[model samples]
Target: MSAITLGAVRPRFRPRRISPARWGLYAFILITALYFLLPLYVMIVTSLKPMAEIRQGHLLALPASPSLAAWVKAWTSACTGLTCEGIRTGFFNSLRILLPSVVISIVVGSLTGYALSLWRVRGANILFGAMMIVAFIPYQVFIYPLVRVFSFTGLGQSLATIVTIHTIFGLPTMTLLFRNYFASLPVELFKAARIDGAGFYQIYARIMMPMATPMIVVAVILQTTGIWNDFILGLVFAGRDNLPMTVQLNNIVNSTQGERAYNVDMAATLLTALLPLVIYFGSGRWFVRGIAAGAVKG
Candidate 1:
Protein backbone atom coordinates (compact mmCIF):
# COMPACT_ATOMS: atom_id res chain seq x y z
CA MET A 1 0.00 0.00 0.00
CA SER A 2 2.81 2.42 0.83
CA ALA A 3 4.49 1.64 -2.49
CA ILE A 4 1.24 2.26 -4.34
CA THR A 5 0.76 5.63 -2.48
CA LEU A 6 4.32 6.63 -3.36
CA GLY A 7 3.70 5.74 -7.01
CA ALA A 8 0.53 7.88 -7.10
CA VAL A 9 2.32 10.87 -5.48
CA ARG A 10 5.28 10.50 -7.82
CA PRO A 11 3.03 10.67 -10.87
CA ARG A 12 1.26 13.75 -9.46
CA PHE A 13 4.59 15.45 -8.74
CA ARG A 14 6.10 14.79 -12.17
CA PRO A 15 8.02 17.77 -13.50
CA ARG A 16 6.09 19.70 -16.10
CA ARG A 17 7.91 20.64 -19.29
CA ILE A 18 7.70 24.23 -20.42
CA SER A 19 5.69 24.67 -23.60
CA PRO A 20 6.86 27.09 -26.31
CA ALA A 21 3.99 29.44 -25.36
CA ARG A 22 5.11 29.39 -21.72
CA TRP A 23 8.65 30.17 -22.77
CA GLY A 24 7.40 33.06 -24.92
CA LEU A 25 5.36 34.40 -22.02
CA TYR A 26 8.39 34.23 -19.74
CA ALA A 27 10.50 36.06 -22.32
CA PHE A 28 7.85 38.76 -22.69
CA ILE A 29 7.66 39.29 -18.95
CA LEU A 30 11.46 39.46 -18.68
CA ILE A 31 11.77 41.93 -21.53
CA THR A 32 8.99 44.14 -20.11
CA ALA A 33 10.62 44.15 -16.69
CA LEU A 34 14.00 45.06 -18.14
CA TYR A 35 12.46 47.79 -20.27
CA PHE A 36 11.09 49.51 -17.19
CA LEU A 37 14.05 48.77 -14.90
CA LEU A 38 16.79 49.79 -17.36
CA PRO A 39 16.05 53.52 -17.05
CA LEU A 40 16.06 53.28 -13.27
CA TYR A 41 19.39 51.43 -13.41
CA VAL A 42 20.87 54.14 -15.57
CA MET A 43 19.59 56.86 -13.26
CA ILE A 44 21.10 55.16 -10.21
CA VAL A 45 24.47 54.64 -11.84
CA THR A 46 24.54 58.19 -13.23
CA SER A 47 23.68 59.62 -9.84
CA LEU A 48 26.63 57.78 -8.29
CA LYS A 49 29.15 58.99 -10.87
CA PRO A 50 30.90 62.35 -10.65
CA MET A 51 30.69 64.96 -13.40
CA ALA A 52 34.16 63.97 -14.66
CA GLU A 53 33.06 60.38 -15.26
CA ILE A 54 29.67 61.48 -16.64
CA ARG A 55 31.45 63.59 -19.26
CA GLN A 56 32.80 60.39 -20.84
CA GLY A 57 29.20 59.64 -22.08
CA HIS A 58 29.22 55.96 -21.18
CA LEU A 59 25.55 56.05 -20.14
CA LEU A 60 25.21 52.33 -19.45
CA ALA A 61 28.49 51.74 -17.61
CA LEU A 62 28.80 51.29 -13.86
CA PRO A 63 30.48 54.06 -11.96
CA ALA A 64 34.24 53.47 -11.40
CA SER A 65 33.95 55.22 -8.02
CA PRO A 66 30.38 55.39 -6.75
CA SER A 67 29.89 58.27 -4.33
CA LEU A 68 26.99 59.85 -2.50
CA ALA A 69 28.33 63.33 -3.02
CA ALA A 70 25.73 64.10 -5.67
CA TRP A 71 22.95 62.76 -3.43
CA VAL A 72 24.19 64.87 -0.52
CA LYS A 73 24.47 67.98 -2.66
CA ALA A 74 21.04 67.37 -4.17
CA TRP A 75 19.54 67.12 -0.69
CA THR A 76 21.48 69.92 1.02
CA SER A 77 22.99 72.51 -1.29
CA ALA A 78 21.92 72.04 -4.91
CA CYS A 79 20.78 75.38 -6.21
CA THR A 80 17.06 75.24 -6.91
CA GLY A 81 16.85 78.80 -7.99
CA LEU A 82 18.45 81.98 -6.70
CA THR A 83 18.99 80.20 -3.37
CA CYS A 84 21.66 77.55 -2.83
CA GLU A 85 19.36 75.62 -0.48
CA GLY A 86 18.57 72.12 -1.73
CA ILE A 87 15.32 70.17 -2.05
CA ARG A 88 15.15 69.60 1.72
CA THR A 89 12.89 72.62 2.11
CA GLY A 90 10.41 71.23 -0.36
CA PHE A 91 10.72 67.83 1.30
CA PHE A 92 9.54 69.23 4.62
CA ASN A 93 6.83 71.19 2.88
CA SER A 94 5.63 68.00 1.14
CA LEU A 95 5.50 66.23 4.49
CA ARG A 96 3.41 68.97 5.98
CA ILE A 97 1.02 68.79 3.06
CA LEU A 98 1.07 65.01 2.77
CA LEU A 99 0.25 64.11 6.40
CA PRO A 100 -2.76 66.34 6.89
CA SER A 101 -4.14 65.76 3.43
CA VAL A 102 -3.85 61.99 3.69
CA VAL A 103 -5.48 61.89 7.13
CA ILE A 104 -8.30 64.28 6.39
CA SER A 105 -9.10 62.84 2.98
CA ILE A 106 -9.11 59.26 4.19
CA VAL A 107 -11.18 60.02 7.27
CA VAL A 108 -13.75 62.02 5.41
CA GLY A 109 -13.90 59.61 2.51
CA SER A 110 -14.34 56.61 4.77
CA LEU A 111 -17.11 58.34 6.65
CA THR A 112 -18.83 59.37 3.45
CA GLY A 113 -18.44 55.90 1.99
CA TYR A 114 -19.69 54.17 5.12
CA ALA A 115 -22.72 56.37 5.27
CA LEU A 116 -23.54 56.03 1.60
CA SER A 117 -23.09 52.29 1.60
CA LEU A 118 -24.86 51.38 4.87
CA TRP A 119 -27.33 54.16 5.51
CA ARG A 120 -30.57 55.04 3.72
CA VAL A 121 -29.78 58.63 3.03
CA ARG A 122 -31.84 60.46 0.39
CA GLY A 123 -30.20 61.27 -2.96
CA ALA A 124 -27.17 59.17 -2.15
CA ASN A 125 -27.31 57.71 -5.63
CA ILE A 126 -27.48 61.11 -7.27
CA LEU A 127 -24.68 62.46 -5.14
CA PHE A 128 -22.54 59.46 -5.96
CA GLY A 129 -23.31 59.81 -9.65
CA ALA A 130 -22.33 63.46 -9.60
CA MET A 131 -19.11 62.58 -7.81
CA MET A 132 -18.33 59.92 -10.40
CA ILE A 133 -18.81 62.48 -13.14
CA VAL A 134 -16.63 64.97 -11.34
CA ALA A 135 -13.98 62.33 -10.91
CA PHE A 136 -13.89 61.76 -14.65
CA ILE A 137 -13.57 65.44 -15.40
CA PRO A 138 -10.05 66.71 -15.65
CA TYR A 139 -9.22 68.57 -12.46
CA GLN A 140 -7.44 71.20 -14.50
CA VAL A 141 -10.79 72.48 -15.68
CA PHE A 142 -11.68 73.26 -12.10
CA ILE A 143 -8.32 74.73 -11.19
CA TYR A 144 -9.17 78.25 -12.28
CA PRO A 145 -12.48 78.17 -10.47
CA LEU A 146 -10.84 76.73 -7.36
CA VAL A 147 -8.19 79.40 -7.44
CA ARG A 148 -10.83 82.08 -7.68
CA VAL A 149 -12.80 80.59 -4.81
CA PHE A 150 -9.73 80.25 -2.60
CA SER A 151 -8.70 83.78 -3.41
CA PHE A 152 -12.15 85.07 -2.62
CA THR A 153 -12.14 83.12 0.64
CA GLY A 154 -8.79 84.73 1.47
CA LEU A 155 -7.03 81.37 1.60
CA GLY A 156 -4.74 82.41 -1.25
CA GLN A 157 -1.74 80.18 -1.94
CA SER A 158 -0.88 78.88 1.53
CA LEU A 159 -0.29 75.53 3.20
CA ALA A 160 -3.92 75.54 4.26
CA THR A 161 -4.98 76.18 0.70
CA ILE A 162 -2.92 73.33 -0.67
CA VAL A 163 -4.16 70.95 2.02
CA THR A 164 -7.76 71.89 1.33
CA ILE A 165 -7.22 71.48 -2.39
CA HIS A 166 -5.76 68.01 -1.98
CA THR A 167 -8.59 66.93 0.28
CA ILE A 168 -11.20 68.23 -2.12
CA PHE A 169 -9.71 66.61 -5.18
CA GLY A 170 -8.97 63.37 -3.36
CA LEU A 171 -12.53 63.02 -2.09
CA PRO A 172 -14.15 61.56 -5.22
CA THR A 173 -11.62 58.78 -5.72
CA MET A 174 -11.25 58.11 -2.01
CA THR A 175 -14.97 57.98 -1.50
CA LEU A 176 -15.31 55.63 -4.45
CA LEU A 177 -12.58 53.39 -3.10
CA PHE A 178 -14.07 53.13 0.37
CA ARG A 179 -17.68 53.01 -0.80
CA ASN A 180 -16.97 50.08 -3.07
CA TYR A 181 -14.97 48.31 -0.38
CA PHE A 182 -17.66 48.86 2.20
CA ALA A 183 -20.37 47.75 -0.16
CA SER A 184 -18.54 44.50 -0.80
CA LEU A 185 -18.48 43.55 2.90
CA PRO A 186 -20.97 41.04 4.26
CA VAL A 187 -24.33 42.66 4.86
CA GLU A 188 -24.75 40.33 7.83
CA LEU A 189 -22.12 42.27 9.71
CA PHE A 190 -24.03 45.51 9.27
CA LYS A 191 -27.28 43.81 10.25
CA ALA A 192 -25.68 42.34 13.34
CA ALA A 193 -24.34 45.69 14.38
CA ARG A 194 -27.75 47.21 13.88
CA ILE A 195 -29.38 44.45 15.94
CA ASP A 196 -27.01 45.35 18.73
CA GLY A 197 -27.15 48.75 20.43
CA ALA A 198 -24.48 50.00 18.01
CA GLY A 199 -25.01 53.38 16.36
CA PHE A 200 -23.75 54.66 13.00
CA TYR A 201 -20.52 56.16 14.24
CA GLN A 202 -20.06 53.26 16.60
CA ILE A 203 -20.30 50.64 13.85
CA TYR A 204 -17.88 52.57 11.67
CA ALA A 205 -15.35 53.32 14.39
CA ARG A 206 -15.51 49.91 16.01
CA ILE A 207 -16.22 47.41 13.22
CA MET A 208 -16.04 48.92 9.77
CA MET A 209 -12.82 50.91 10.14
CA PRO A 210 -10.98 48.04 11.74
CA MET A 211 -12.18 45.62 9.10
CA ALA A 212 -11.18 48.06 6.40
CA THR A 213 -7.51 47.98 7.28
CA PRO A 214 -6.49 46.83 3.81
CA MET A 215 -8.50 49.60 2.17
CA ILE A 216 -7.08 52.15 4.56
CA VAL A 217 -3.55 51.14 3.68
CA VAL A 218 -4.47 51.41 0.04
CA ALA A 219 -5.96 54.85 0.59
CA VAL A 220 -2.93 56.04 2.49
CA ILE A 221 -0.63 54.81 -0.25
CA LEU A 222 -2.68 56.43 -3.00
CA GLN A 223 -3.04 59.75 -1.21
CA THR A 224 0.58 59.88 -0.11
CA THR A 225 1.86 59.22 -3.62
CA GLY A 226 -0.62 61.48 -5.39
CA ILE A 227 -0.12 64.38 -3.01
CA TRP A 228 3.64 63.92 -2.91
CA ASN A 229 4.08 63.73 -6.68
CA ASP A 230 1.66 66.51 -7.59
CA PHE A 231 3.39 69.36 -9.36
CA ILE A 232 0.87 71.60 -11.11
CA LEU A 233 -1.48 71.79 -8.12
CA GLY A 234 1.39 72.37 -5.72
CA LEU A 235 2.89 74.98 -7.98
CA VAL A 236 -0.45 76.75 -8.25
CA PHE A 237 -1.78 76.29 -4.75
CA ALA A 238 1.22 75.95 -2.44
CA GLY A 239 2.65 79.35 -1.68
CA ARG A 240 6.21 80.21 -2.55
CA ASP A 241 7.19 79.05 0.92
CA ASN A 242 5.60 75.63 0.42
CA LEU A 243 6.77 74.30 -2.93
CA PRO A 244 6.95 70.50 -3.03
CA MET A 245 10.03 68.40 -3.85
CA THR A 246 8.90 67.95 -7.45
CA VAL A 247 8.89 71.70 -7.96
CA GLN A 248 12.30 72.02 -6.42
CA LEU A 249 13.66 69.20 -8.53
CA ASN A 250 12.20 70.83 -11.60
CA ASN A 251 13.84 74.12 -10.74
CA ILE A 252 17.16 72.39 -10.23
CA VAL A 253 16.94 70.46 -13.49
CA ASN A 254 15.66 73.29 -15.66
CA SER A 255 17.98 76.01 -14.42
CA THR A 256 20.27 76.78 -17.39
CA GLN A 257 22.27 79.54 -15.78
CA GLY A 258 25.35 77.31 -15.60
CA GLU A 259 26.58 73.94 -16.86
CA ARG A 260 24.02 71.22 -16.19
CA ALA A 261 24.88 68.91 -13.28
CA TYR A 262 23.52 65.61 -14.58
CA ASN A 263 24.48 63.70 -11.45
CA VAL A 264 22.73 66.17 -9.20
CA ASP A 265 19.74 66.25 -11.51
CA MET A 266 19.40 62.45 -11.45
CA ALA A 267 19.84 62.37 -7.68
CA ALA A 268 17.28 65.11 -7.16
CA THR A 269 14.79 63.39 -9.44
CA LEU A 270 15.30 60.12 -7.59
CA LEU A 271 15.01 61.85 -4.23
CA THR A 272 11.72 63.45 -5.23
CA ALA A 273 10.39 60.10 -6.45
CA LEU A 274 11.75 57.98 -3.59
CA LEU A 275 8.87 58.51 -1.17
CA PRO A 276 6.13 57.34 -3.54
CA LEU A 277 8.21 54.42 -4.73
CA VAL A 278 8.91 53.34 -1.17
CA ILE A 279 5.29 53.62 -0.08
CA TYR A 280 4.00 51.76 -3.14
CA PHE A 281 6.55 48.96 -2.97
CA GLY A 282 6.33 48.53 0.79
CA SER A 283 2.53 48.27 0.83
CA GLY A 284 2.03 46.76 -2.62
CA ARG A 285 0.46 43.65 -1.17
CA TRP A 286 -2.03 45.63 0.83
CA PHE A 287 -2.88 47.73 -2.21
CA VAL A 288 -3.59 44.60 -4.20
CA ARG A 289 -5.63 43.11 -1.36
CA GLY A 290 -7.69 46.28 -1.05
CA ILE A 291 -8.52 46.30 -4.74
CA ALA A 292 -9.46 42.67 -4.57
CA ALA A 293 -11.59 43.39 -1.49
CA GLY A 294 -13.91 45.55 -3.59
CA ALA A 295 -12.24 48.69 -4.80
CA VAL A 296 -13.75 47.93 -8.21
CA LYS A 297 -17.11 46.67 -7.10
CA GLY A 298 -20.24 48.82 -7.09
Candidate 2:
Protein backbone atom coordinates (compact mmCIF):
# COMPACT_ATOMS: atom_id res chain seq x y z
CA MET A 1 0.00 0.00 0.00
CA SER A 2 3.09 2.23 0.15
CA ALA A 3 2.93 4.84 -2.65
CA ILE A 4 -0.05 3.06 -4.16
CA THR A 5 -0.83 5.63 -6.88
CA LEU A 6 -2.22 3.55 -9.71
CA GLY A 7 -3.50 6.33 -11.93
CA ALA A 8 -3.95 5.10 -15.60
CA VAL A 9 -1.42 2.25 -14.86
CA ARG A 10 0.20 2.67 -18.34
CA PRO A 11 -1.21 -0.82 -19.13
CA ARG A 12 1.91 -2.52 -17.66
CA PHE A 13 3.84 -1.72 -20.89
CA ARG A 14 2.52 -4.86 -22.52
CA PRO A 15 5.25 -6.40 -24.71
CA ARG A 16 4.45 -6.27 -28.43
CA ARG A 17 2.36 -9.26 -29.42
CA ILE A 18 4.95 -11.53 -31.03
CA SER A 19 4.78 -15.18 -30.02
CA PRO A 20 7.78 -17.54 -29.60
CA ALA A 21 6.68 -19.43 -32.68
CA ARG A 22 6.72 -16.17 -34.65
CA TRP A 23 10.11 -15.34 -33.23
CA GLY A 24 11.28 -18.80 -34.22
CA LEU A 25 9.86 -18.23 -37.69
CA TYR A 26 11.86 -15.00 -38.02
CA ALA A 27 14.97 -16.74 -36.73
CA PHE A 28 14.45 -19.54 -39.23
CA ILE A 29 14.04 -17.04 -42.05
CA LEU A 30 17.22 -15.20 -41.07
CA ILE A 31 19.23 -18.46 -40.95
CA THR A 32 17.72 -19.57 -44.25
CA ALA A 33 18.64 -16.23 -45.86
CA LEU A 34 22.19 -16.54 -44.58
CA TYR A 35 22.34 -20.10 -45.90
CA PHE A 36 21.35 -19.06 -49.41
CA LEU A 37 23.58 -15.98 -49.43
CA LEU A 38 26.65 -18.00 -48.37
CA PRO A 39 27.38 -19.17 -51.92
CA LEU A 40 27.20 -15.66 -53.38
CA TYR A 41 29.43 -14.37 -50.61
CA VAL A 42 31.96 -17.10 -51.25
CA MET A 43 31.93 -16.43 -54.99
CA ILE A 44 32.37 -12.68 -54.69
CA VAL A 45 35.19 -13.06 -52.21
CA THR A 46 36.88 -15.79 -54.22
CA SER A 47 36.48 -13.91 -57.49
CA LEU A 48 38.17 -10.89 -55.93
CA LYS A 49 41.02 -13.10 -54.68
CA PRO A 50 43.80 -13.96 -57.13
CA MET A 51 44.36 -17.45 -58.51
CA ALA A 52 47.36 -17.65 -56.14
CA GLU A 53 45.03 -17.23 -53.15
CA ILE A 54 42.51 -19.62 -54.68
CA ARG A 55 45.21 -22.27 -55.06
CA GLN A 56 46.30 -21.63 -51.48
CA GLY A 57 42.81 -22.79 -50.37
CA HIS A 58 41.90 -19.55 -48.58
CA LEU A 59 38.29 -19.89 -49.74
CA LEU A 60 36.92 -17.08 -47.55
CA ALA A 61 39.89 -14.75 -47.08
CA LEU A 62 39.52 -11.06 -47.99
CA PRO A 63 41.63 -10.13 -50.98
CA ALA A 64 44.67 -7.98 -50.25
CA SER A 65 44.06 -6.07 -53.48
CA PRO A 66 40.82 -6.80 -55.29
CA SER A 67 41.20 -7.26 -59.03
CA LEU A 68 38.87 -7.97 -61.96
CA ALA A 69 41.46 -10.17 -63.67
CA ALA A 70 39.50 -13.31 -62.92
CA TRP A 71 36.36 -11.72 -64.34
CA VAL A 72 38.30 -10.59 -67.42
CA LYS A 73 39.82 -14.02 -67.78
CA ALA A 74 36.34 -15.52 -67.54
CA TRP A 75 35.06 -13.13 -70.18
CA THR A 76 37.84 -13.29 -72.78
CA SER A 77 40.58 -15.85 -72.06
CA ALA A 78 39.58 -18.83 -69.89
CA CYS A 79 39.56 -22.19 -71.62
CA THR A 80 36.77 -24.72 -71.63
CA GLY A 81 39.16 -27.31 -72.98
CA LEU A 82 42.54 -26.72 -74.68
CA THR A 83 41.66 -23.40 -76.32
CA CYS A 84 41.82 -20.41 -73.98
CA GLU A 85 39.38 -18.42 -76.14
CA GLY A 86 37.07 -17.78 -73.16
CA ILE A 87 33.26 -17.95 -72.98
CA ARG A 88 32.63 -15.14 -75.47
CA THR A 89 32.57 -17.49 -78.45
CA GLY A 90 29.18 -18.82 -77.48
CA PHE A 91 27.77 -15.45 -76.31
CA PHE A 92 26.22 -15.02 -79.74
CA ASN A 93 25.10 -18.63 -79.77
CA SER A 94 23.12 -18.13 -76.55
CA LEU A 95 21.64 -14.89 -77.85
CA ARG A 96 20.65 -16.60 -81.11
CA ILE A 97 18.77 -19.27 -79.20
CA LEU A 98 17.56 -17.00 -76.36
CA LEU A 99 15.92 -14.24 -78.44
CA PRO A 100 13.96 -16.44 -80.84
CA SER A 101 13.00 -18.82 -78.07
CA VAL A 102 11.64 -16.02 -75.85
CA VAL A 103 9.70 -14.36 -78.69
CA ILE A 104 8.19 -17.51 -80.22
CA SER A 105 7.31 -18.98 -76.86
CA ILE A 106 5.42 -15.84 -75.86
CA VAL A 107 3.57 -15.66 -79.18
CA VAL A 108 2.55 -19.30 -79.14
CA GLY A 109 1.63 -19.10 -75.46
CA SER A 110 -0.43 -15.94 -75.98
CA LEU A 111 -2.29 -17.44 -78.94
CA THR A 112 -2.97 -20.70 -77.17
CA GLY A 113 -4.15 -18.82 -74.07
CA TYR A 114 -6.38 -16.51 -76.13
CA ALA A 115 -7.94 -19.43 -77.96
CA LEU A 116 -8.48 -21.55 -74.89
CA SER A 117 -9.74 -18.59 -72.88
CA LEU A 118 -12.18 -16.99 -75.32
CA TRP A 119 -13.12 -19.37 -78.10
CA ARG A 120 -15.43 -22.35 -77.63
CA VAL A 121 -13.51 -24.33 -80.24
CA ARG A 122 -14.24 -28.10 -80.30
CA GLY A 123 -11.88 -30.31 -78.29
CA ALA A 124 -10.27 -27.15 -76.95
CA ASN A 125 -10.91 -27.92 -73.31
CA ILE A 126 -9.78 -31.49 -73.80
CA LEU A 127 -6.55 -30.35 -75.42
CA PHE A 128 -6.03 -27.78 -72.67
CA GLY A 129 -6.62 -30.40 -70.01
CA ALA A 130 -4.12 -32.68 -71.68
CA MET A 131 -1.61 -29.84 -71.72
CA MET A 132 -2.17 -29.22 -68.02
CA ILE A 133 -1.73 -32.90 -67.27
CA VAL A 134 1.49 -32.98 -69.21
CA ALA A 135 2.78 -29.86 -67.49
CA PHE A 136 3.49 -31.81 -64.31
CA ILE A 137 5.69 -34.33 -66.07
CA PRO A 138 9.45 -33.70 -65.89
CA TYR A 139 10.74 -32.40 -69.23
CA GLN A 140 13.52 -35.05 -69.26
CA VAL A 141 10.87 -37.63 -70.11
CA PHE A 142 9.94 -35.72 -73.27
CA ILE A 143 13.54 -35.21 -74.45
CA TYR A 144 14.17 -38.63 -75.99
CA PRO A 145 10.98 -38.58 -78.05
CA LEU A 146 11.48 -34.97 -79.09
CA VAL A 147 15.13 -35.54 -79.96
CA ARG A 148 14.17 -38.40 -82.24
CA VAL A 149 11.42 -36.31 -83.83
CA PHE A 150 13.70 -33.33 -84.42
CA SER A 151 16.49 -35.55 -85.73
CA PHE A 152 14.05 -37.09 -88.22
CA THR A 153 12.71 -33.68 -89.23
CA GLY A 154 16.28 -32.62 -90.14
CA LEU A 155 16.08 -29.82 -87.56
CA GLY A 156 18.57 -31.71 -85.41
CA GLN A 157 20.91 -29.64 -83.26
CA SER A 158 20.09 -26.26 -84.78
CA LEU A 159 19.00 -22.89 -83.31
CA ALA A 160 15.56 -23.23 -84.87
CA THR A 161 15.15 -26.68 -83.40
CA ILE A 162 16.26 -25.37 -80.00
CA VAL A 163 13.68 -22.60 -80.19
CA THR A 164 10.95 -25.07 -81.09
CA ILE A 165 12.03 -27.37 -78.28
CA HIS A 166 11.78 -24.47 -75.80
CA THR A 167 8.33 -23.56 -77.10
CA ILE A 168 7.12 -27.14 -76.74
CA PHE A 169 8.50 -27.49 -73.24
CA GLY A 170 7.25 -24.01 -72.31
CA LEU A 171 3.79 -24.49 -73.86
CA PRO A 172 1.91 -26.05 -70.99
CA THR A 173 2.88 -23.60 -68.24
CA MET A 174 2.61 -20.59 -70.54
CA THR A 175 -0.80 -21.65 -71.83
CA LEU A 176 -2.03 -22.37 -68.32
CA LEU A 177 -0.80 -19.02 -67.04
CA PHE A 178 -2.40 -16.88 -69.76
CA ARG A 179 -5.55 -18.97 -69.92
CA ASN A 180 -6.10 -18.66 -66.19
CA TYR A 181 -5.29 -14.96 -66.30
CA PHE A 182 -7.65 -14.31 -69.22
CA ALA A 183 -10.34 -16.38 -67.59
CA SER A 184 -10.01 -14.14 -64.54
CA LEU A 185 -10.69 -11.03 -66.64
CA PRO A 186 -14.30 -9.90 -66.98
CA VAL A 187 -16.09 -11.93 -69.64
CA GLU A 188 -18.24 -8.91 -70.39
CA LEU A 189 -15.26 -7.23 -72.04
CA PHE A 190 -14.90 -9.99 -74.62
CA LYS A 191 -18.67 -10.25 -75.05
CA ALA A 192 -19.06 -6.51 -75.64
CA ALA A 193 -16.22 -6.57 -78.15
CA ARG A 194 -17.94 -9.46 -79.95
CA ILE A 195 -21.25 -7.62 -80.02
CA ASP A 196 -19.50 -4.64 -81.63
CA GLY A 197 -18.46 -6.79 -84.63
CA ALA A 198 -14.90 -7.31 -83.41
CA GLY A 199 -13.20 -10.55 -84.48
CA PHE A 200 -11.12 -12.78 -82.18
CA TYR A 201 -7.77 -11.36 -83.17
CA GLN A 202 -9.13 -7.83 -83.11
CA ILE A 203 -10.45 -8.12 -79.56
CA TYR A 204 -7.37 -9.93 -78.42
CA ALA A 205 -4.86 -7.52 -79.88
CA ARG A 206 -6.68 -4.26 -79.32
CA ILE A 207 -8.43 -4.98 -76.05
CA MET A 208 -7.53 -8.01 -73.95
CA MET A 209 -3.82 -8.29 -74.69
CA PRO A 210 -3.24 -4.71 -73.61
CA MET A 211 -4.57 -5.56 -70.18
CA ALA A 212 -2.36 -8.64 -69.89
CA THR A 213 0.95 -6.92 -69.19
CA PRO A 214 1.32 -8.43 -65.71
CA MET A 215 0.67 -11.95 -66.89
CA ILE A 216 3.02 -11.45 -69.81
CA VAL A 217 5.75 -10.19 -67.49
CA VAL A 218 5.32 -13.31 -65.43
CA ALA A 219 5.54 -15.50 -68.52
CA VAL A 220 8.65 -13.64 -69.70
CA ILE A 221 10.27 -14.30 -66.33
CA LEU A 222 9.57 -18.04 -66.45
CA GLN A 223 10.58 -18.56 -70.09
CA THR A 224 13.67 -16.34 -69.92
CA THR A 225 14.98 -18.13 -66.84
CA GLY A 226 14.09 -21.63 -68.02
CA ILE A 227 15.36 -21.23 -71.58
CA TRP A 228 18.38 -19.16 -70.65
CA ASN A 229 19.57 -21.49 -67.89
CA ASP A 230 18.68 -24.51 -70.01
CA PHE A 231 21.82 -26.65 -70.38
CA ILE A 232 20.36 -30.04 -71.17
CA LEU A 233 17.85 -28.90 -73.78
CA GLY A 234 20.40 -26.56 -75.32
CA LEU A 235 23.02 -29.29 -75.13
CA VAL A 236 20.84 -31.89 -76.81
CA PHE A 237 19.24 -29.50 -79.31
CA ALA A 238 21.75 -26.63 -79.68
CA GLY A 239 24.55 -28.94 -81.05
CA ARG A 240 28.35 -28.70 -80.96
CA ASP A 241 28.78 -25.40 -82.83
CA ASN A 242 25.98 -23.84 -80.79
CA LEU A 243 26.89 -24.96 -77.28
CA PRO A 244 25.61 -22.29 -74.87
CA MET A 245 27.66 -20.62 -72.15
CA THR A 246 26.14 -23.04 -69.65
CA VAL A 247 27.64 -25.96 -71.56
CA GLN A 248 30.97 -24.15 -71.69
CA LEU A 249 30.71 -23.45 -67.99
CA ASN A 250 30.09 -27.14 -67.37
CA ASN A 251 33.14 -28.04 -69.38
CA ILE A 252 35.25 -25.53 -67.49
CA VAL A 253 34.02 -26.67 -64.11
CA ASN A 254 34.02 -30.39 -64.87
CA SER A 255 37.11 -30.94 -67.02
CA THR A 256 38.68 -33.93 -65.21
CA GLN A 257 42.35 -33.75 -66.09
CA GLY A 258 42.43 -30.04 -66.82
CA GLU A 259 43.17 -27.68 -63.96
CA ARG A 260 39.96 -26.09 -62.66
CA ALA A 261 40.17 -22.33 -62.17
CA TYR A 262 37.76 -21.98 -59.23
CA ASN A 263 38.04 -18.20 -59.35
CA VAL A 264 37.06 -18.04 -63.01
CA ASP A 265 34.48 -20.72 -62.44
CA MET A 266 32.84 -18.52 -59.81
CA ALA A 267 32.95 -15.50 -62.11
CA ALA A 268 31.54 -17.52 -64.98
CA THR A 269 28.69 -18.80 -62.87
CA LEU A 270 27.82 -15.25 -61.85
CA LEU A 271 28.00 -14.12 -65.47
CA THR A 272 25.73 -16.94 -66.60
CA ALA A 273 23.18 -16.00 -63.90
CA LEU A 274 23.17 -12.28 -64.81
CA LEU A 275 20.42 -12.42 -67.47
CA PRO A 276 17.73 -14.10 -65.40
CA LEU A 277 18.76 -11.97 -62.43
CA VAL A 278 18.31 -8.88 -64.64
CA ILE A 279 14.83 -9.93 -65.65
CA TYR A 280 13.93 -10.61 -62.05
CA PHE A 281 15.36 -7.29 -60.82
CA GLY A 282 13.80 -5.30 -63.70
CA SER A 283 10.22 -6.55 -63.26
CA GLY A 284 10.69 -6.91 -59.51
CA ARG A 285 7.63 -4.81 -58.64
CA TRP A 286 5.10 -7.05 -60.37
CA PHE A 287 7.31 -10.13 -60.00
CA VAL A 288 6.24 -10.44 -56.37
CA ARG A 289 2.56 -10.65 -57.21
CA GLY A 290 2.01 -14.31 -57.97
CA ILE A 291 0.62 -14.31 -61.54
CA ALA A 292 -2.57 -16.28 -60.98
CA ALA A 293 -3.35 -15.56 -57.33
CA GLY A 294 -6.61 -13.72 -56.48
CA ALA A 295 -6.63 -12.83 -60.17
CA VAL A 296 -10.29 -13.63 -60.80
CA LYS A 297 -11.45 -14.66 -57.38
CA GLY A 298 -14.77 -13.07 -56.44
Best by TM-score: 1
Q: What is the lDDT of residue 90 in candidate 1?
A: 85
Q: What is the TM-score of each candidate against the true structure?
A: 0.88, 0.86
lDDT of each: 0.86, 0.79
- Superposed model 2: Cα runs more than 4 Å off: 1-27, 290-298
Q: Which ranges in model 1 have alpha carbons more than 4 Å from their true place? A: 1-15, 18-26, 289-298
Candidate 1's residue-wise lDDT over 17-45, tens digit each? 98888889899999999999998999999
Cα lDDT for residue 222, model 1? 72
Q: List clashing residue pairs in candidate 2.
A: none
Candidate 2, residues 75-187, lDDT tens digits: the string is 89877778777777766778888889888988898889899988888999999989877777876788899989989998888888988888988887778778877888999
Q: On a 0 to 1 TM-score scale, where does candidate 2 land against the true structure?
A: 0.86
